[model samples]
Target: MQDRAEATRNAVLHAAAELFSERGYAATSISDISERSGRTSGAIYFHYTNKEQLALALVDAHFSAWPSVIARHDATARPALEKLVGLSFAVARTFRDDVLVRAGARLWTERKSIDIEMPLPFVDWITTVERLLAQARAAGELAAQAEPSRDAPNLVAAFFGLHTLSDVLDDRMLIEDRLANFWLLLLPGLQADPAPRALLARAGGRVTTGHPARVPDGTER
Candidate 1:
């Protein structure tokens, strides 16, 4: 019974994510989710008291999704700047493909209309980027002027803007390439020794050429 109930709840949430992504937050309602999920309105209410709660659930899930991704890359022994670059590509793919993430993104953008406050967007993202960049500095992967605290926000902003444009213009068809372009432009100035452009594949992550990872030379970064 517990497992069945969880499945039902997941079905409803998935339906809600689809609707919330296809239709903006204000435009989506409990009824829409019900129809999409083929679940009774009563069942939905049993899992989620109201539309606001449902929306909150999906948005919160999206927020929860990133940490595991970051943790996965961090767990590996790759260079931090490489991790940073790889993280961006991974995120771009998720934002493009994941309906729940799209719903959360829509909810975030249309947060003004939500009666209840959603988690403040971008704060965690900024913190994660800052941490990765700090690791990059410690790894001697960053350029001398690349202050993590100062640069993290700008990188996040650019990433956010790039995706926003991608979402608006073409349902994110070109986003992977566009993001790779972003990395291409930023890498030379950002990395201690930016490697040849092997092209970042958003479907996976950054594709590197055969060049070896940089070792920290005695000179200051």
Candidate 2:
């Protein structure tokens, strides 16, 4: 009974996520979710009191998504720099492929419409990047000139810009490609030395998902 109930909840969530991804929050209705999920309205209500609750769940999921990906790379015992490179690609894939993430991005943008307080975006990512970058610099995998404190927020901003632009310009198929290019452009400036920089030369095109497929392999945003 518990398993069945969980499955029903997931179906509703999935349905809602897909709709929210395809349509803006204002455009999507409970009836649309019902049709998409094939679950009764009562079932959805049992799990989520309303659409705002569903939106918050996806928003929370997006924020919650980073740790598992980080765990995957952390388990590999690779240099923090390599792990960071792989982590970026992993997140790109998730942003492009995961309905939950896709909806989460949309929901975040539409947060004002939802009555409940949502998690503030990007602070955790900036903090995480700062920590990893410090580790990379300490490991001598990054340049002496590199400043994690300054770079972390910039890196997060750049990544999210790529994430959002790819979605807006071409349905996100170009995300990995764009990120790879961005890495190609960034590494020469960001890495501490030639060898360390080379580690991320293929940044735009590579994926480090053995970590879990999202940081799931990065910044978690």
lDDT of 1 at 91: 86
Q: What would the TM-scores of all predictions be?
A: 0.87, 0.88
- How much is the lDDT of residue 93 in candidate 2? 92
Task: Give one digit per residue, the lDDT tens place, for model 1 in 124-214.
Answer: 8899999988987888878898888999899999999999877776678667666776777787778787652742442245454323322
Off by over 4 Å in 2: 195-197, 201-204, 207-221
lDDT of 2 by residue, 1-221 (tens): 99999999889888888999998888999889988999888888899999899998988888788789878876887777777878888888988888898899899998888788998988988887888899988898787778999999999999998888778767886566567667767777767676433575543345332121122223232
How many clashing residue pairs are found in candidate 1?
A: 0
Off by over 4 Å in 1: 196-221
Cα-based lDDT at residue 140, candidate 2? 84
Each model's C-alpha lDDT?
0.81, 0.80
Candidate 1 similarity to native, TM-score: 0.87
